[model samples]
Target: MRILVVEDNLTLASGIERLLKQSGYAVDCVHDGLSAEAVVSTEAFDVVILDLNLPELDGLSVLRSIRDRKLDSAVLILTAKDAPADRIRGLDLGADDYLTKPFDVGELEARVRALIRRKSGARSPLVSFGALTFDLNARTLTSEQGIVDVPARELSVLELLFSRSGKVVHKHVIIESLSAFDDDLTPNAVEQYVSRLRRKLIPYDVTINTARGIGYYLSKASA
Candidate 1:
């Protein structure tokens, strides 16, 4: 999943970025709310980890702007504020959840998982497309043939594609979904990964097709 971490503290931002990256999420971090708002306005993310205290614009203002524009991505408030009123205010501003500083990383991850699950309308942790089944909780893929171990990046790509099956997903969209917002990974690198995935899906009759100048589309060939 792709997540935006909006924290002004350099240490906390870097730590969150590193942790989320290690957990197989494409993460983008900004030290100020202006940059955070800019990033959110231009790109799509599964979730936003927003801090209330920010430079240029406060987190509440950012959240208000997001709601004003009707952006539907989930927002999880991460801040030093521990008061019930502060938490209630964030919820009222449209945040999906809130976590205070010095929080458990495990619990934060669990809440993130729950938020994503609810957003995707998934009742179970497993995501299926055709004969292939992806265990989101376990980060594994299985099919009638056998269990196929997928790398983190490939698994993320598959998840994005499967989530919007049969639709044409722009190349840039795939790139952003698979790469960290701050990572220098080139757009061509995204093509390379998609090429690799296409080869792997051959046996399953699933195809990832390029639309030449348009983008990529995933489809299952009729048996």
Candidate 2:
């Protein structure tokens, strides 16, 4: 999954970025609200971790702009304001979830996962195909034999494919989801990750089928 963190505090932003990255998410961050607004307008993110007290634009305005554009990314409001009125205003403005600051990082991660599940219409964290099962919460893929050890990048690619399951995910979309503003991943790199995943999946009767020039999708091996 991809997430955008909009927090002016350099320390907090860096901490959140590192935590999410460790959790197998592609995360991009911006300190000011203007940059946050601009980033949201251009790129697609699975979730936005937005702080209300921001420089230049402020969080509510950023949230409003996001809603105005009708972007589908889940917006999670993270702020120090614990006022009931503040919470109501954010929700009324289309925020999907709210997390008060001085909160547990674990809870924040859980909320993000919940939002992703809600958006994808997935009731369970485990998504399976053939003999392979992907645990979203654990960020691991397991086969009939045992839990498969996958490199982070390849695991990310696998996550994208599983999220879409049967749909043909275009190459550019994979590129976007795998990359942040500073990290650039090429189409060839995507192929390499997919290639590695294919090898691992063969034993489980699962395949990552290429869509010719486009991208890939997950399918069960034919009997």
Tens-digit lDDT track for model 1 on 1-223? 8899999999988888888888898888888889988888988888999999999999999999888889988999999999999999999989999999988988888888777777766768787777788776656789997798777787787776765656777777777667665577676877788889988888887778878887887777563
Best by TM-score: 2
- Against the true structure, what is each candidate's TM-score? 0.84, 0.96
| CA lDDT of every candidate | 0.83, 0.91
Q: Candidate 1, which segments miss by more than 4 Å at Cα?
A: 144-146, 184-188, 209-214
lDDT of 2 by residue, 1-223 (tens): 7899999999999999999999989999999999999999999998999999999999999999999999999999999999999999999999999999898999999999889888877779999989888887778899878899999999988877886788898999888888898887898899899888889888888888888998899988764
lDDT of 1 at 201: 85
lDDT, candidate 2, at 62: 99
lDDT of 1 at 31: 82
